[model samples]
Target: MSNDAVTPGETRFYQGEGQTQPLFRIEPGINCQFAREQASELMGYAQDLVLDGLLERKHNMIWAAHYLNALAKALLDDAELGLAKAKAL
Candidate 1:
């Protein structure tokens, strides 16, 4: 029930030259299996957000939905790249 071993010191992805934007943190491992599990979980959550926004017509939800969708895409891309790297090794 601990991830201290796999975890690293810095987890967040920082943007900008000044490091102003702290977008998100990476999942625990660089392995494909971990990537797939994390991606599937994120996709499910993002899809739910989008669906909830569409059904209820909440303006805030819509905004969140967009960001979540983009995050999911980024996560999937990372997962695919991780899978490729893992296969090559």
Candidate 2:
């Protein structure tokens, strides 16, 4: 946690990040597809916001999309490994 937010395509546990509940928790289970859908919805919202010229909140939506998709990927990766080493987000 170097005063920087967690970026997409990353799964680093900051010094104090794991002490609190994660903003988004993607479990390695049947809910993965739903997580993907939610990520897509976030992307759509980001796109729509940009189209409407709403610049302020668009980045939030886009960031949500990125991280949600990343979490979904992590979930699937854990499932692929037989869930033995799956972390609970």
Model 2 residue pairs with clashes: none
Top candidate, metric lDDT? 1
What is the lDDT for 57 in model 1?
86
Residue 64 displacement (Å), model 2: 0.6
Q: Model 1, residue 7: displacement in angstroms?
A: 13
Look at candidate 1 and tell me the lDDT of residue 46. Answer: 70
- lDDT by residue (1-89, candidate 2, tens digit) is 12121223223222234466445433433343444455566566645655554456556655555554455455444333332223323
Q: Residue 8 deviation, candidate 1, in Å? A: 13
The estimated TM-scores of all candidates read: 0.57, 0.34
Residue 27 Cα positional deviation in candidate 2, in Å, after optimal superposition: 6.7
lDDT score at residue 11, model 1, on the 0-100 scale: 40
